[model samples]
Target: MRNPLAAGAATGVLVFFVCFYTKLLNPTSLPAEPANQVARSINAEDTGNNRMHANANAHISWQCLSESDLRDSINSTENVIVVMPAKAAGTSLKTFAKSCNPNTTENLQTLLSKNDAFNLLTKSWDMPGVYASHFWVPTALSQLLRSISRHTLVVYIHREETSRFTSAALHVLTQWCAHGPPKAQKNFFDKVENNNHKCHVREKKLVEILKDRPQEMQMGTIELLTCETYSSIEEYAPNMLFVDYKRANVLQNLLAERYCPKMTNHSHHIGKGAEKVFVQLQNGGTEVSLSEWLEKKSSYLEWTLGLNDKASCLVQTRTMEDNLSTCDGSFIHAQAVLNY
Candidate 1:
């Protein structure tokens, strides 16, 4: 009532002290706009363009690797090397990898050494992995041995041997007869039948190679080479993943979810078109069914090797049924052919 200016000054000081104490007690109550912006920037960079980016913040539990654990390993690692055979849905794997991490390249044949492979793997700033399809293990073993790292993850995609052989053979046949005359198809068939012919000779050599060093052959064997390579790599690498081409569709989703978490929906359509071509070939034959045709081809391959049960050694009939079932009506046709 007496000194109004002095009283006002005292009130202002009290309010200031109260506000300071409140801020001190709850430091996080203030908005950190600059820090938030930086965090946002980093997240954007990590998730940009489906490119493979390093996950420094990833929580990796190596002791128990689930699908998520494998993904975390892939995301956190500097290199992921995938070895797959031809006609083993490698294209689908590549497509899935692109959707998950655009920073991947499938160029194993071109790389000479592990260092070269590593260089290619990290060519892009945020690359996740490098897929090397249609590769021979023996040829690339030296380089692969050289290129292994603590952060490296090696994956091998396995297919049924007989189905792989049939698919590869049919693929070659389809390509050879794509636009050619019927006579060209007959000639090609003749070449395949003749043991001395280039096709027959090559097939024979491939079988021998598979027997001697299954790892050297593009189409691996059931017994030695491929299995040995798999066991050896498991012992050598810190992280290794095996993808059965038979269950590729399901596994693809699991992998995509881990590597490309931001992607809402992902689908793989590799090798679908090839099914139509296979169906057309099956229907085109009037006297023999597609399975019979495949058998005849298998017989010829066995004959080249001068063995009665050589076909058994090359491919498993049960696996063939599972593989053919995926081809539209091809399995049904094969069953009819078998019955006839």
Candidate 2:
């Protein structure tokens, strides 16, 4: 009779070999990666076209870009530039990267390890045709971008402050603060045990950090609290493409358009049905939306309202002449509120 034990052993060996080869062939059949992790190139033709546009001074094609092309451009050239607000929801650095390439978990981990905005700048200054995102985009980055690129396109994103703050706080608690150095201990929380109080403290600290003159201004916890501040980026970078950060598919479409506009038209959220909403606490309203709460505290609104009494000769100044003309001799009440 056949040896039952020998037969069983032979079958087990064959199964193990098959399983090992399957794993070697298909790596992505493994577990999921972290949020915003790049996977692989979704489109190749678009990627090649974007690389050509990015490499030279040609017009951008509206097509889906591939991860390999993006990676090659980044690895090879250092001429192009991209700016993104940190902690933005619609399009983040990870989202942008994913549009071109599917980065692995290991790759993302390596990037996070070198998350310093300044360091990345210094290291990549010599490269060409690479558009990178610096979280804060410090003075060094601004100077570098201004120096190299022939045609620079600035994309600015606007979102309701409260939503961004909430997302940012959670990101800090979960990502940076959780694994950050001992110095970041005060920012992290173990759980939502007292999230209300924790949120308040975090907000206060953020506001304090963002406090200062315009030149010294920087995004902190509270800066993202104002819808106006995000939109007001135009005042700083006039040529910037201000996009509503709340729109879905914005980041992907933007990248696709930048690389290959014809094949993949990136429709801006500008005229899209409803605009982004921010609810303010009605001076004495009991229940106020988070967006409204942020508006009340944002420096952008504070500065605008504060300038009303000063009567500066600014270009877009709403002078008494404009207001009086609109009144047209009607019973101009001393106080008629115009909410727009």
Candidate 3:
């Protein structure tokens, strides 16, 4: 009753002092969630209808890094391991790791680079200080790199499943034809072999790894490699990073430099062959649009071969030098046309 305004002002001052004292007494704790929405591919859960989007406000610690930043991380960390999944940008990462620090990187890479399982069994390969001899050897459903040191960084570069499968399929087809241009009657899928060190993530293997293995599986030289999918990567390593394969297409650039250093980036762009195709098609002059005409005619010059972007190198088996044959889709289609 004695000046309500004075009493209210006093109450406000008390509240302010209380809050300030609390802040000083105990520093603010980190938010409940860790790194948020960094991995748009994995941190995101699929809702439906074939769309990719991150979970809104989802708590996570995994960082999505660019090539430059990841290279720096690789250089700085005392012990680093890259999960080199096949048909992913692994070759390029390997190139960068070697370039960054040949000593530590080479020390680790050489132990298992031969990729000879029997040799691993028979030989007494000296273990690197860090237990990472088998880290990069990724098979489908493979466990990726992990680190206990908060200082250590673990990296996984992911390519989307379908696109990767297409690449693998193409590789197999190339291998089949490279053996000998097969008769059109032969079963293309007959007795296909598993990849040597090649893998694309498969849904089947992912389920097995999640259900079968320990959340924090450790590695040994004899360990058969498992390429880890994103869902439970945090369990394997506290500090995990997801490098989207498409975002970090450094392999192509590395290959370009190593193989054809003189060729500028734009030199790879489409040339007049494409323009000639368009012109010839236009000259056909169907009343219908040329695109629609091609659809009706069931023929169009296919350059990309389901390849969306320029690949670092068009993958081929080493044996191709000895036994090269045509695996061209158009050629195959020409053979199969009568089958339809």
lDDT of each: 0.47, 0.35, 0.35
Question: In model 2, which range of ten residues has the least summed lDDT?
Answer: 330-339
Question: Which lDDT tens digits does candidate 3 get at residues 274-339?
Answer: 110111223443233222323343321123122212221112111121121222210000000111
Clashing pairs in 1: 50-102, 52-126, 162-315
Q: All candidates' TM-scores?
A: 0.48, 0.33, 0.33
Better lDDT candidate (1, 3): 1
- Clash number for each model: 3, 25, 4
Report the lDDT tens digits of candidate 2 across residue range 1-340: 9999999999999999998898899998776665444433333322321211111222211122234433333334323344444445433434444344333112221243355434444453332222434334223322332333324444334433334444443344333322431353454222222323222223333334233212212342223212222222212222223333453244445455445344354443423222121222334434333334444555563353231222222211122223323432211111112223
Task: Give residue 259's lDDT in candidate 3 (0 to 100).
Answer: 30
Candidate 3 clash pair list: 142-226, 142-227, 143-226, 252-312
RMSD of 3: 20.2
Best model number under TM-score = 1
| Root-mean-square deviation of every model | 25.6, 26.4, 20.2
The deviation in Å at residue 329 for candidate 1 is 26
lDDT of 1 by residue, 225-304 (tens): 22223323333443555455665565565555555566535555644233212212333433432234566566454345
Order of quality (TM-score): 1, 3, 2
